[model samples]
Target: MKKTLLTFAVVLAIASASNAQTKIPPNIEKLLQKNTCLACHKVDVKLIGPAYKDVAKKKYKPEQIVELIKKPVPSNWPGYIPMAALPNVPADEALTIAKWITTLK
Candidate 1:
């Protein structure tokens, strides 16, 4: 029982550490909230859509990200449900969010 508890504690600590590493900046957090982007995406963990970090791993430029936000391609992410295109998101706000997303990694 003691061994099991110790292992659990170690796993919890590692999870916390990883979560801590994905802190979102206040400005970006505001934009995400305002645009309802947080409903589907998170900085590190997957929600309804891919995590921002995972998107960053794709190395898409900010402009490309903005385009994706406005017109998402379902084929880009297999297995996950297709992201709805956010054509209503203002271009400037989308670009701001995109620029920040590209810096996640």
Candidate 2:
């Protein structure tokens, strides 16, 4: 019975992880590419920027994430690799990206 339960748990974990692979919204995807945000960030894996999964875990309101993207939060990220302020990136685009990121699990 213990072995059976363990197998079931493993299967469940795999299923959940697979189901949580969120896609980038079309406009957000285009914005990321245009703004070069994709160079440092990915929808799943951690690159120079933390993964979208990590961002979603913060549970911050969508508005907060938008502000962070526009201004950056080096303290929250903490490192020699400080987040660059995306002053050139439009605020509306950042908010769209933020809303999409919140759907990541």
Judging by TM-score against the true structure, name the best candidate: 1
Per-model tally of clashing residue pairs: 0, 0
Name the weakest run of 10 consecutive residues (lDDT summed) in model 2. Answer: 19-28
Q: For each candidate, C-alpha RMSD in Å?
A: 2.3, 3.4
CA-lDDT, candidates in order = 0.91, 0.83
lDDT of 2 at 102: 82
Checking candidate 1 for backbone clashes, the offending pairs are none
Query: Candidate 1 lDDT, tens digit per residue, 11-54?
Result: 99998998897788898889899999999998888898999999
Highest lDDT scorer: 1
Deviation in Å, model 2, residue 21 alpha carbon: 4.7
